[model samples]
Target: MRHRRPEDRRPPWGVRRTVFSGLVPLVVLFGWFTLAIRLGLPSAEPVGFLPFVFVAFAALVGFGRWLARAGILLALLGLLPVLAVLLGGWTATGDEILLSRGKPVVVLVSAESAHRLKAGLAYTYDVRNPDGSTDSLEPGVGTRLPVGSQVTVVEDPDRLVAPQLAGRQDPAVPLVFACLGTASLVAVVVSTAVAGERRRVRNATTR
Candidate 1:
């Protein structure tokens, strides 16, 4: 059998750095999700398949220059969700507005006073409209509007049945966040492994 050359014997440094970098995001996301659950938010079950993917990618890219490139790509991809959350870009799209006769300003009577609907709630009439007409809505209409609050009716304001707070719950937002997280984790693992292997080789050469 032909002898293995020393140059081809070891892995690259970039892989080591990628592995470490990947772990940083993983820890952060795990801590965040744990805190969210403690804070009474509904947290989705953890994805079980991610660790295997990370291991596989790291093994495949180990000692390869491609690990360095992948590390950069993943780090950049991870930023997408972060920016979306920060800039209020996580709001849902394709929202439909409906028409309803509304008073410019109405006093919130109470949560109990709001008419409960199948998916949302409606505000009850305790005040008159600008046209001085008695405003009445179906029991479930306008239910999404918060009680004890005042809203401006620029146009007929049809609200969501399960109205989330403004600028919350974008489908794209969570998906991007998850993607960023997964990619970053993989990059970290691969890069870290490569870097460690390179360090070993360098140390061996010096000795």
Candidate 2:
């Protein structure tokens, strides 16, 4: 039996390496997503898909055996929220742009009902359109107004997107989702790389 070198015997998933691998990707992703939001980019799907691609590449290159499997699982689970963030961002951005070009009509919409979802509380509203037509609208999450309370909202003339509450276009929701999704992907990459490095070192020592 060949004796393993000191370097090879050291823990591959050391605190420093784990933290470095996790944080670097997270910081980079945060910056990228923030920039995309500022620039009014329709979606961040390309960057969001990077973790999956990286996992596939790692598998091809014979990295960590467990990495490929775990990475794929993590990436898939993370992808849902990432896709949601992008889609919601795209819709919100489009609504803002459209409303900017045209005059937004302010209307008083009464809360029809409120219900709790697994994600959060959601509100349904009874809206009277400028065209004198009545419609029921369920604006996805984040309203605290009591039922029957008349809330002011800017009606989209084209109805391409859901009516947004007046003076309430917040980017915080998307940012939160972006962070969560990115962190999941980062964990996969970092763990996989560390495992692969340890395997390589062990193989070299045994030879």
Pick by TM-score: which candidate is best? Answer: 2
Give per-model TM-scores: 0.30, 0.43
lDDT of 1 by residue, 180-202 (tens): 65455455454544565566567
Pairs with backbone N, CA or C atoms under 3 Å apart (clashes), candidate 2? none
Where does the lowest 10-residue lDDT sum fall in candidate 1? 89-98
The residue-by-residue lDDT of candidate 2 on 7-126, one tens digit each, is 986665545555564455445544654554444332212244445344434432332234333445545544554455444455456455545743456454654676776778876677
* Candidate 2 TM-score, C-alpha based: 0.43
Stretches of model 1 off by over 4 angstroms after superposition: 1-163, 166-168
On lDDT, the candidate that comes out on top is: 2
Model 2 CA deviation exceeding 4 Å by range: 1-67, 71-103, 108-111, 118-121, 133-151, 176-180, 193-207
lDDT of 2 at 201: 63
**What's every prediction's RMSD, in angstroms?**
14.4, 10.1
